[model samples]
Target: MSHATTSIAAEQDGPADIALSEFFDGHPVATFAIDTAHVVTHWNRACEQLLGWTKADMVGTANHWQAFYPRPRPLLADVIIAGAAGLESELERLYPGKHRRSALIPDAYEVEEFFPNIGASGHWLHFTAAPLRDGNGRVVGAIETLRDVTERRVAENALRRAHDNLEHVVDKRTGQLADINAKLQEDIAQRLLAEAELRRSNLELTELNQQLSRAQQQLLQADKLASIGQLAAGVAHEINNPIGYIFSNFRTLQNYLDQLFGMLDAYQRAEPSLAAPDAATLRALRERIDLDFLRQDIPTLMAESGEGIVRVRHIVQDLKDFSRVDANQEWVWADLHRGIDSTLNIVSNEVKYKADVVKEYGAIPDIQCLPLQINQVVMNLIVNAAHAIGDERGRITVRTGRDGDDHVWLEIGDNGSGIAPETVSRIFDPFFTTKAIGKGTGLGLSLAYGIVQKHSGRIDVDTALGQGTRFRVRLPIRHGAATEDPTA
Candidate 1:
């Protein structure tokens, strides 16, 4: 051949030799090259080792379809044709027949079959294919490769299943936790509401207790006033008896004096000449009339009238001391005995009918208190004791003493039908009375409690049904002094 023809032929031959040499390298993948006529142009050392074939057996082979795959790979043929006609294509493929003559594959290959190829010595093969193109971007042939990827595929499928199961378990646990949290929040809300209700109930009870205390004070005051009114009526009757006699004697004396004046006037008119009587004659007439007796008797009468007026003044003073309308006034040192005596006098009428008072006075110090209010309290307690006895005569005991520390105590007890357990608790409330409607206003004990509280004192009672009742009042010895009364 000429030199130019020799160079051109050498270049063509060089590339084919290089391509074949590169395919013969001991790579793991089975590689092959095919021509546009679908004939095998080259086969690698890997293909020969995996498929039990050599380059001598597969090269220049027109059966490229049956040689590269254990079965004819139909999808590979389609992809090659389309790409040769200028289209893009991609696909995945599984290996054909099973190794060791397993029943998974047939001897003759088919397009749809995935079978492993087993050589005589029991080697397994896996296959995949792709189309090849020339520099002009036109598909000219195809290249196929194969591998042993059985272990890898199995492991990947197991891993995917495990991940899906784990996800499902996590979702279920999250749903359960959300339910538990919602229930816990609802329980907490219910407990809070219950606690709030309990607090409100306690507040209501406290308010009711305060109201009861106030009502008791009002009842005590009313009882006291009723007793005082009854006493005043008795005292009025007592004083009226003595006053009636004194007035009758004065009227009789005035009549006698009027008669004597008439006689003297008649004498003066009858004897005009003797109208201006001599001093000696006038003196003799005065002597006969007993001027010294008239003077002595008139002075005695004036003195008796003054004594009656003093008695009335004493009664008035006692009444004023017993009634205490100014209970809010400040405290002062007060004689406990004097207060008890005044209260007893005020309620004497009530007790006289059904009870007798027994005094047991002690040498107690003056108690700091509102005197009039304290007296009113005593009056209420004493009178209530008498009323409790009804028609039966009972003994009412009034006692005074000093307690430990700076306090004075007065106790009034009666031998009468006592209070019931249920009734005793509410005995001091306003308008709480066992007496008939017209006879009691029920403010006595209630007012007494209020007065004691104002003085920072306390009043307590002990009683049993059918065993009589005892009321005890404890007052401070010294307290804030009372201010001067503006009305005084």
Candidate 2:
């Protein structure tokens, strides 16, 4: 070989060896070489930085198994020995002391049980060892590389824990929400049922109210008929008294006329001359039978008959007034006092035994109303007040006055045994009364209530069991005016 050829070969050899050493030293992982005696031979800068050891301190001096893995050092022995026999194995080893060191190393080393020595605060390392072969393919030593995987493993564990916790929380919250939704559904169902029941109850109540109204109307009609019957009986009794005497007077007159006719027939049967003489006898007979008394008694009988006719006419008029058949005939401004007086006259029979009436009439405006209907209402109330006294000779005070704007007020008060608290609430209800069955019809107050309401008015009662009762009725001054009266 020439000098130039030798120089060229020498230059190529020098750079190639330097390049190999530089590549090994500058690697990002810890690099080391183990000898056949299972001892560390070479250590790179990455190894020094990772393990806190210098190459001169650990190389050729100690085995990695004795220094790093104190307990169970054979755990790495099997892995490395197996790799030397062309088998693959991986070993994990944990170091004692603070910042426990953990490592994973794959083995295919020339010597058995050979690993790198690491230090405290060292990152977790994953290492792979490959058996170094000579040109003849004979095992010589091993080169191992280690990488830091501590941060990745720690982050993966943290992420896994967080994921697990989130799943657990989601499952718990989902169960709670389902329970709440079920409760809400139950509450909604109960509310719907309650509303349906309320609607049903209201419908039933409306039907009951309609039935009660119809019953009330029937009761009122029955009561009016009863009153009419009583009045008819009274009128019949009154008429019979006068009629009996008038009929007796007519029979007496007929007997007197029969005696006179018999005397006249006797005169006709006598002889004509003797008849002239019998005239004196006839005059004596007439005088003795009292013809003048008969003539005077006949006029008295006619007068008695005329008086009976007048009484009947008056009774018929009272009946017409009580019935109010002509109530809607016309509207007229009427004196309320006069109507009240008339009502007092009609019910005088009711109160005569139990109560006395006193009137306190104030200057009031003439109210436009149906006089007959108002009279009926007043009479009913007066009679009720009398009956309430119950033979106590109580006093009833009837008063009239102008109330507030556009209203007229009438007050009828009784100094009688008043209403009981329990009965007061139902006093105006139809068929409710404190009196005995034959003495009272129970429709008096109810009819009065209806009549007052028809006139756009209200009736209020103030009573206490020993404190007497006062009933105040408020009516509009004008026919169609609104009423401002509080009754409850």
Candidate 3:
């Protein structure tokens, strides 16, 4: 009803009704009331503000549904007036899942729904309606309250969408991580296989290297024996010449001694028999014995014998130096020239027959090396030089010098037929030779090359046809020293 009609009804009901009307108008909630006939009885100030229809226009009219819906329909208050018999079914029909019984008020129902005509866009509102009954418990009218919940509903929907998007992102990332883990596992497996294969190859290579080392040592021993045999034969021949002459001298000396003793015995017998010592007999004996000649020749024989002994001693000393028989293959500082000289002595028999040795020694420092091995290098080069000479007598030049400050070098050159171009390349290869079988084992140059390499040195050959060949060996002054082109 309008305010004037409400005032008129209040006047009829007395002061208590007036207080009730004032209370309804002053309430904060947007509320409206309906009569038993479904006519609008009261529209509070809050309801007028919410629906944009003043109490002056809505009170006493049955058009309250116009505020929330597009056409005339029962409001929540009308639904309550339909009575409790089919109340739940009626609420289910109107609001579906949005309606429920009020938790705080008996015989009251609540619903939250969107009303398109309630605002500029729309509004979500939660509204509750309860019955107003008479003293006899008969339904007389109903009161409805509304609350705007648009902002809360919008925020809840945004949060739900965010939660769904987060779930999708987490699932996608988990799948990607699984794929990466599989790839990494496969890579590890492949790497393990590769490592195992590499280890097997290394073990095989180590065994092969050990076998090759044994073979190389055997070859070296064989070469040394061959060279020794050749040296022994030559040394015997050289020593025999001196020994034969010395033996002949000893026989002659014995004869001279016997004749002298016979003459002395006769003199002694005559001295005892004759007063004048028989001078003529003595003279005859002296003339027969050739005393003056014996005197001169005996001293000469002794000198020659001593010289032969000295030669023998020197040969033995040279052999000792060349072989280093007492040495334990240790690195030591030694005179390269001294080693070269001893090597020359040992191999002299090989070279002397075919070549005249010319020594060109230079002032050089001692070097650190395995002395016996160095001697082997010199021996090999000299032997090779001797072999290079042809039928005609040749000159073998042995040269030694310092190369800069860090290295020393020795060159053995022969004035024989030079090495062939094809033969030069394989000269240092084991068992490769130009000599006839039984003459050369061909390990001389190869062993020499290996020794020089072990000393961190180098060997180079220079040759021209008929002009002869020169083999130069350069060695570091200090054992294990870094190597460079010393000639450069």
Candidate 4:
């Protein structure tokens, strides 16, 4: 369909085709219509806009297959036209079960399939095709409409990955959970037996209320444990990737060591032998073994392996510091910058792939606080920033500075999608998440809020939709409560 030919056809088309063309041109979705002979009668403006084929190139032609496929195969629209004429048996062989009859429409079919030749690469389309009939109720042709559903497909895949990760962690912890359950049952049995003691009757009422309180605490702790279980898997993976290569390098070094040792043994034996091998034989051995390459590479390989071990150890230490594994949970004078650094290291795996982290540090005084708990708050903020950025390359800027003489402040900002104004207030509310299921526990900000509050600090949010978000945490330079309550 050349441009000049389409212009002539538009001028000669019947009133009915003109009216249909008018309707399809302004339609909201990508649409096209063809006549009984499979010749394209109308290619809408939206069709041209979406499929990159101008009306001049598509109208008055039956080459619709070129827009979607490499060869002339019957499209879903063709299937609809054929099926409407009772050619169901052949369509079965043509398309198999790749498409389905539209449950909501009569004599229509819908399909969600990948169009490999569309756009820059492949694109997923959600489209439906229906027979276009005339006043006498005969099939005149077929009209097809479609839209790109690639973003929805991406979200579905992320949800699936999240679900799989959660399931994997649950399966790995099944044994630990079973052991805990067995021990819990034994504890209950022993306590019940102890309740039968003659002196226990006096405190039974108090014990019941206490047990109820403990049950609530246990539930709270269970959530914490679940969070920990999830973190453990990610941390394990972060450690494992480097360790895997490190161990592999070391194994290769071991083989190299054996080879070198064998060469050394040969040299030692030759030195004591009355009839040592001639120079050519030794030269051949060295060349066959590639001694020159080994001399240069062995140290380099060992050095790289050593660096890998250092990396693994540093990550392990950061995890320990972030989790307060071996440190007291008491409030103390702590370096805020160091705390932030450790927290960033702890969640490095989470952020590294999502965005580039930029640290903007300034001079600030150490504050009296629960350092590890503060690190937890920092981790939550950093992770939230990472997740808020959609699946595109983004940047997160972390800044630390002084706020007057009494307070110090830190900011975590992202140049990704920001929060909506209406939902900003409710963001701190527990269990309110914008993320899809299985990706968040929704306790991140809530926990961060509580932790900051305990430190007598406040979290202020600055955000604009589609621009970005920055969360600022301001704490007093020092607190007087350090001596009053050690745990605080």
Q: How many pairs collide in each candidate, listed in order?
A: 22, 0, 2, 0
lDDT of each: 0.66, 0.68, 0.82, 0.78
Choose 1 or 4, whichever is better by lDDT: 4
TM-score of 2: 0.43
Error of 3 at 276 (Å): 4.5
Model 4, span 382-472: residue lDDT tens: 9999988888989999999998888888999998899988988888776889888998877788777766766778888899999899999
Candidate 1 deviates by what RMSD? Answer: 37.4
lDDT of 1 by residue, 1-488 (tens): 22344346447898875765585555667777665665566688887776667788767655655553556654353345444233222323332332122143322121223234445333333544555555786665666556655456567668889989988998998999999988878799787999899999999999998878666654555565556555655566677667667667756766676676567566545554464566457657768988657756865776687677666656655665565433333466678898788778767787787877899998888877767667777877887888888566889999989887677788999988898888777876767877787988776776776777766677888888788999988777887533222111
Candidate RMSDs in order: 37.4, 38.3, 37.7, 22.9
Stretches of candidate 2 above 4 Å error? 1-185, 188-286, 291-305, 328-349, 353-366, 370-372, 392-397, 436-442, 464-467, 485-488
Write down the worst ten-residue block by lDDT for model 1: 105-114
lDDT of 2 at 102: 27
Candidate 3 clashing pairs, residues 3+ apart or interchain: 1-41, 1-60
Give the lDDT of residue 423 in candidate 4: 89
User: Where does candidate 1 stray beyond 4 Å?
Assistant: 1-191, 194-205, 208-307, 324-328, 436-441, 480-488
All candidates' TM-scores? 0.42, 0.43, 0.48, 0.47
Task: Kindly indicate the candidate among 2 and 3 with the higher lDDT.
Answer: 3
